[model samples]
Target: MSENVLHLENVTMQFGGVVAVNDVSMDVNEGEIVALIGPNGAGKTTVFNVITGVYAPTNGRVSLRGRVIAEDHPRGKMRKMYAAGHLGEYPRSVNNTPDRITRLNMARTFQNIRLFKSMTVFDNVLVAKHMHLKANFFSTALHLNAREERRMREETMELLRIVGLENECDEIATSLPYGQQRRLEIARALSTNPSMLLLDEPAAGMNPQETEDLSAFIREIKDRFGLTVLLIEHDMNLVMDISDRIYVLNFGALIAEGTPAEIQSNPDVITAYLGVAEE
Candidate 1:
């Protein structure tokens, strides 16, 4: 296995004539928390889109586990293979589909909470297990497979416990406090059994105390789940405190890549944010 779980090389994406991401290359090593941070319109989320198959890159390539999914040449034709139902052949794609990526052991949380608001907190996590559940829809709908149904419920409760939400299993998702909702989102994503987790602003709308607890929770889950996390966050404190390495993007291009301490001292990052040279 490669040391890196995800790799993007000279990747670019454009909407009409507006380039959202340009010639950006990055590598996320296994079991590390890598933060992608930049000001608005810096193409932070654009990079995420390309990697997660939300948008096909106009140029460049994306690779996962040594397979090229997107590239500048004929190899970029892997996208066609994916479209043709040869889903197992490609690990990356210029236009890879999201479902295929999820099946590849990569799962992501959205910038906005996307829980089943009408469902219980436990059900929110339970829904994710559907992808891995072995029971057929027919068996589940008819309740003919008692064993499978029981197994699913057990798995769901176990996942809730892992996220520390076992007690809130029956509460409506929207009724949970904001911070717990965020934790529920993480638990839901984890139910997919992902090897690589993509978190988009997991700390958004969180108070200081909540963010503090979230920071520790993230680290704990990373260790417990043995997951490699690629996070997009604007909270400098959270990013600096938790990420092992940081990648800074500006104007759809990578500006700097370094450790937290190094990024804290980088003049370009300060300039990009404050529009003034560091004293």
Candidate 2:
């Protein structure tokens, strides 16, 4: 089996001539933690969108587990042009929905907390679990699959325990403290049993102590679940500490890709984050 779990090849996304991501290519290897970091609008999220099937690239290909999941003008009108130029390489069919992508054992959490505000914390995780149910809707509607429901409930409780949210399971999702709410989001994502996880700014609104706890929590899950992670975050310290490799983007372009130590010493990377003075 290939060591790479995900690969983006020359992926370019243009929104009506406004290029959000330009000819960017990167990879996430099996069982490694990788990070994509850059300025506020450096197309980090755009790349995430393309990879996750939220949008198809104007020109490029995206692969997961060596399978061409999306290619040839994905969600837009760029298909024939792309295939005409690349032929066999771009013949991949478009139109894998976000839900379909999740079933491929890839899951993600948004930068903003997107928990079910009205649902109890437990119910939120249960939602993802129900997706894997084998019972048909007719069986579910008639309450004829009580065993499935019971097993799902047991698994949901186990998942909450693993994420340290067992105590908050009964609370309304939005009622929890900010940090706990974030934990709940992670729990919800994990309910799908994804092999690879994508986290968007998991520490975005956290304080130092919360961030510290979150960093540890992320590592624990990665190790315990035997999962690979690709994250988009701005917390340099956290990124440097946990990531095995880093990819830096600036204005929709990839400027650098390396380890934490290498990225820190690269002059171009320094200039991208902090400007160079006129000499």
Candidate 3:
């Protein structure tokens, strides 16, 4: 059986009384491409935020490689305010920051493209590479890390080459076409050398052709880097085409999960997306 690369057990996130993600649990096995899909306000991105450490979930645990990386349960003031998921399942809070999570072999892109607009494509990637630097602050400031810097630059170029952005390395990030800007963001995420990648609406603004190209590109990089991916996408065609398994969420709760064929036939999923018909 494939090892589970990521596991969420009874995870929930609440903002005051609003339960954005409620009692959600899912898994992504090593090397599998998993898609999280649902209608608007389904709390898809909320789950992504919880996973990426943008928010410490109000309940349950998030595990990576069988180790619990984040966990918390309703407590203090939250204890009385409409606790969701399993209550008190995790007594301690284990909120790892986003950068710390990235260092621990997880990286993500945003729902909206986030790039260093003032920086060149190469520099944008280089910044991510800085997270793995070995030299101390003093060495970096004194220019003694020159060799390491040079190596990073070379690797950045190689990554750009791999992503077909080599020619645009000198261009300002926001100056690239919309599709390429999206690719650049992914490239920057890749620079972190993650085992798992979380992509938030990667195909949000793409035309059909760009979406198709993105599907192929996602597969290519997955194989090339040996990555396990979890993505949120509304484009059903791309989701169905690329996902090894699909997890459906409605109103922050998982409604269905199965292969593409099974999900396509599921009544709950159909009703969630299209609503009930009058008799």
Candidate 4:
């Protein structure tokens, strides 16, 4: 059997009285391209936030490679006000910071393209490589790790080359076309050398050709880098075309899950997206 890369069990996120994600459970196996899709406000990105440690769930647990990275139970006001699913089952509090999670061999790109606007494309990627540096703080500060720095830059350039951004390396990051900017963001995430990648709306602003190219690129990198991918996307064509399996959500609740063909034919998914018919 394939190894499990990421898992979420009975996960829920409550802000004040608003429950953004409700008792969701999902998993992605190594080498699989899993898609989490739903209509707007279905809590897809909220799920991503919970998974990446941006928000500690009000209840439930998140695991990576059999290691529990985050777990919590309702407390204080929530304990009395909200009916938190799976409460008391996961009593451990292990809320890791985002950087801590990234250091655990996982990386993600944002829904809105976030790049270092003032930095060059090369520099943007080079900065991400610093997380893996072996040199101490003083060695880096004193410039004593010249050899390692050179190797890092070389790897950054090679990464840019692989992502078709080497030609734009010297250009200011914000100066690139919108599609290439998105590509650069993913390339920056890859610089961290993650085995699992979470892409949030990667094709959000792309034209048809760019979207097509992106589908190919996602598959290419998955094979090239041996990556397991989980993505939130609105483009049905792209999702159906690439995903090994899919999970559907509606109103913060998981509605259905199956292969692309199965999701396409699922009545609950169709009703969630299209609404019920009148009598």
TM-score of 2: 0.94
- Expressed as tens digits, the lDDT of each residue in 148-230 for candidate 4 is 99999999999999999999999999999999999999999999999999999999989889999999999999999999999
Question: Could you give candidate 3's per-residue lDDT for residues 1-279 as a string of tens digits?
Answer: 899999999998999999999999999999999999999999999999889899998898999999888998887888899557467568888989988989999999999999999999999999999999999999999999999999999999999999999999999999999999999999999999999999999999999999999999999999999999999999999999999999999999999999999999999999999999989
lDDT of 2 by residue, 154-201 (tens): 999999999988998999999999999988898899999999999999
Task: State the number of backbone clashes in model 4.
Answer: 0
Inter-residue clash pairs, candidate 1: 61-70, 69-92, 69-93
For candidate 4, the 10 contiguous residues with the lowest summed lDDT are: 79-88
> Per model, how many backbone clashes are there?
3, 0, 0, 0
**What is every candidate's alpha-carbon RMSD to the true fold?**
5.6, 2.6, 0.8, 0.8
Clashing pairs in 3: none
In model 3, the Cα lDDT at residue 162 comes to: 98
Q: Give the per-residue lDDT of model 1 (tens digit) for 1-279.
A: 439889987776666546677678899999899999999889988888778888776667788878765554213433342221222333343456887788788889988888898999978888887777677888878888788767878988988888899999999998999899999999988988899999999999998888999999999999999999999998888999999999999888788999999999999988888897558
Q: Which candidate, 1 or 3, has the higher lDDT?
A: 3
For each candidate in turn, the TM-score is: 0.88, 0.94, 0.98, 0.98
Question: Model 4, which residues run further than 4 Å from truth?
Answer: none
**What is candidate 4's CA lDDT for residue 226?**
99
Residue 61 C-alpha lDDT in model 2: 89
